[model samples]
Target: MADATPYEDSTTPSPTVLSQDITLNWKTKATVRLYRPAVIPPKKKLPLIIYLHGGDFVLYSASTVIYHNFCNDIAAAFPAIVISVEYRLAPENRLPAAYFDGLNAVLWAQNQSLGIGGQDPWLEYADFTKTYLLGSSAGANIAYHVALQLLDYDLRPVKIKGLLMNQAFFGGLTRTQSEKNLIEDAYVPLYVNDVLWSLALPTYMNRDHEYCNPISGGSYMGRVKGLPKVYIKGDYGDPLVDRSILLAQYLQSCKVPVYYRFNQGGYHGIELQNTSAAQQLYNDMTWFVNDVYQNLNSQDLSHHHASY
Candidate 1:
């Protein structure tokens, strides 16, 4: 599996968005690519989007062209400040390693938002209080884990207002209906999914472990409380579809604000898969972001309910 993205040079502005990369951790050389509208309104701060690209968990980096193009679209469409992170991958780092990198990335954003560390010029246009996290496929799985883990931190001024998961990659020892039904899926086959888990999960852990299957954990509820509003997108034709629905149901059951859409005839990361699918994905994302922003700006979202 691989997770990554980057298209234009740091110095180049693609018609709408301008992007640049910054190293987050010097020792590990972990980096994050930042994107914002080519032209910004003076004194208008935009929402911050921390995104993770997917490749199951074993492949890719922020330089992956497909993911990079997607980020460009997101930054321009939302007219937001987007940060695509580069993390330690599996087969070498494994499970919690990526999760930890995710936490570090969030914290780094917190510091930037608070001006604890020196701030970047682009971040000056970011409304740190309206932060969001987005991830696709295995990156979504990482996003989910990161959101939960963040509940344990104190990132004031860096509120996570929403989470967006696109065809989140999750599995278990027991086959879900969608997993069995889509075993021979064209986009991501069952065999390849199994191999990804084998290489990405902890050496001694099986598919039933908490990282692979969140519902399998008895105390997951305690860990998942107070998560930001969640927007989950599942592709009916993808092998991970069941897990996507299952996650939404679980989070809703926990009373976490949830909004989900399960579209027919699509595969994992469909947004990055093709032009049409990408348009729909962004449209869905736009709707969700707009709703969340409107609610946050005008009223309290603490009472937000599940909307499928």
Candidate 2:
């Protein structure tokens, strides 16, 4: 059975933002909740952020309380169009299942951009040229893979500016220092992570499966050469911090422009723990999105929005 979005009321506009749900696939219940700033700046097409929520790929929905609040905050703060994807979870639907749903969500956005599907008014303000995939933990993993999935697609009018990952939950067969040190972690125990892997990964695969550990660098790793500029962020207290470090190292070696912000201390998903951290994250995200226009892209964002 597919999990339903548990949020009872999403239509009412908050002071900062407004949100509503869209059912992308009726059968599988694949859905996306679209969020936009309440008072959209007229005549200004904002950047598009296709967000995947974090729950070890086995828990949470796009409408889950924490993820919803996170999206609302960022949509208002970054003042961008934030589309949160709700895909089926695992122990029932595993690995590639969530990944494919991520791709589908992106395709839906593509259709909206090309005006091929039923269009929504908020999406009309999306500056596809300034698009981004933003996710945290397991969602970050999905964002990275989905970005790879779109590599072959022609990106003339809609280019993904960059990826924004926060404490990506990557794993490996051999333990890193942080993983070993944090095995007895209070917030995220290693035992719990193992259980999640068992549920989310394919029956035949283990922790080292490419989906869990991209650091192994196989065919999928080679494809990452075409990845957009990346913004990877993590805190020192998380066990997976080492894997985040390893991923940043590998991408840098591949000559992909990788921006990293590793703070001194934070548990798994610190942003969810309090306001200060989330604000700092929003701070980093706004800077990154702005930097994408100022540095990674050739045309000025205002000019791009006007001309396109």
Clashes in candidate 1: how many? 8
Residue pairs whose backbone atoms clash in candidate 2: none
Tens digits of per-residue lDDT for model 1, 1-308: 01224345656545688778887766787888889888998999898999988999999987699988889999988768998888889898998999988888899888887776688878899998888899998889999889988888899989998999988988889998888887898888999989999999999899999899988885556877688788887777787888877777777777777776677777776777588878777877777776743222222233423221
- In model 1, the worst 10-residue window by lDDT is 293-302
Each prediction's RMSD to truth? 5.4, 7.6
lDDT of each: 0.81, 0.82
Error of 2 at 217 (Å): 3.1
Tens-place lDDT digits, model 2, residues 125-210: 99989999998999999999899989978755778989988999888888888888889998779999888999999898988889
Local distance difference test, candidate 1:
0.81
